[model samples]
Target: MGLYDRYLALRVRTTDAAVPEHVALVITERDLLEQGAYDTLRDFFAWAFEYGATDVTVYVSVLDRAAAPTLARELEDLDAPREVAVRQPDDVERADAPITVGIGLGGRSEFTAAIRDLATAVDDGDLDPDDVDETAIEDRLVFPNDPDLVIKTGAERLSDFMIWQSVYSELYFTDVNWRDFRERDYLRAIREYQDRNRRFGE
Candidate 1:
């Protein structure tokens, strides 16, 4: 660790506020195409875990459906700190690993699919329409873990990810692109998150 990185880590460790346990990152497929993108991701996981994050979720937006398979394969093969679960757009199965990656799965499509599943259950007499609620919707989500903090690099806008889960997450946006992201950037995000007085929309 460099001196500045050590300083940022010290700040995060000494903060009065609680650090985020679950962290989410938003990036595009183009970002991963850049040189050393996977190395950046590996470092990100290391930083997250080092600073008290227990779970990490990465949402990679893809404009082309044909690229989904290749992206998934690459992400799954990343030499990360922990086990990774990579899910495609049509994959509804829950990802239970410490690190989860979602490729090409927009939030709108996920919500639509959840609603479709709810409707099917209602029609089949397995669940009543009146019983359907937030839990019902969440149960049908692919990556259902709600993050305490969400980080978006290179843009202020979220890349249509974890709409249902991130309703109360503290968001951190940085102009730094994915390829240039460093451990200091990750620590800065942790420090920012630690400084916030999280009021879950209250």
Candidate 2:
């Protein structure tokens, strides 16, 4: 780790409570299996629990069932890991483990916005609302926005993790890798979020 990273770690450790509920982790198949990286995930869950997160979801795309067994086994070993469930967009509703929805996206954007747009069109009479069911319309809509702050680390650019939900979320990116993630870094991010003046179109 660099001196700056070490500095951030120190700051996070000294910070106060700032964790929010409803945490979602977006991980590619390559990051989990190919990268042989499960420790970062374990750490994230551990920290999320420590922060008092009631609901936590792990979002995955392009999954291989063969890899699921090993990952599930590892997750089963942890105390809070059992609370974490794997999901695809189609099966998000069936998720019983603390509402951990797996949002699947076959199109260009994440499903949430598309669903909202589609529903709005139906509501606006632009499309036939009778064709879609009430539950289906509700699923596509990303209402009750729970995301307040989203931290994208290791990569300077924002990945398509919570593209729809994070439309107005405070974004903080770091070059630090997942393995090096520490409590202090998390705290600093929260502190930064606290300091921001959110202007949601006035």
Candidate 3:
């Protein structure tokens, strides 16, 4: 860690505010095309875990549906510090790992799919419509764990990302692009998170 990074880490460690246990990153599919982008991802995982985060989620929003399969294959082979579970739009299996990657899978699509499943069950007399609740919806989603902090790089826009789960998450947007992201940038996000008073949608 650099001198300033160490300082920020110390501040985070000494602050009364809680460190984010689960950190989520929102990036675009084009961001990955940049050189050294994958290295940044591996380093990002290390940084998140070093700063007291146990789980991390990377949402690689895709504009072209055709890119999903190639992106998924690359992410599955990432040299991450922990085990990773990669999920795309059509994947019904839930991705529950220390590191979960979502490629081309928008929250709206996932939510709608879950709702459609429940509707089908109700129609078949397998599940009652009145019994459906938050847990039921979450259980059907690909990645169910809600993030404590969500960081969006390059721009402030966070389209189609965790619509239901991130309702109460603290958001941090940085202008630095994915290729230029560094440890200090991540530490700054953590510092900012610790400095805030989260209301959890109060």
- In order, what is each prediction's RMSD in angstroms? 1.0, 6.1, 1.0
Candidate 3 per-residue lDDT over residues 60-140, each given as its tens digit:
998898999999888889889999999988886888899999998899998999899989989999998899999889989
User: What is the Cα root-mean-square deviation between model 3 and the actual structure?
Assistant: 1.0
Per-candidate TM-scores read 0.97, 0.59, 0.97
lDDT rank order = 3, 1, 2
Q: Candidate 3 — number of clashing residue pairs?
A: 0
Tell me the tens digit of each residue's lDDT in model 2 across 118-145. Answer: 7788889987876676455445533323
- After aligning candidate 3 to the native by TM-score, how far in Å is the CA of 17 from where it should be? 1.5
Candidate 2 residue spans exceeding 4 A from truth: 1-19, 34-36, 61-82, 89-96, 99-138, 141-145
Would you list the C-alpha lDDT of every candidate in the order shown? 0.91, 0.55, 0.93
Per lDDT, the best of the predicted structures is 3
lDDT by residue for model 1 (1-202), tens: 8999888888889868799999999999999999999989998999889889899999999899889999998988889899999999788787899999999888888889999999999999999889999999999988888999999999999968889899999999999999999989988888888878889999
lDDT computed for candidate 1: 0.91
Candidate 1 scores a C-alpha RMSD against the true structure in Å of 1.0
Candidate 1 local Cα displacement, residue 126, angstroms: 0.4
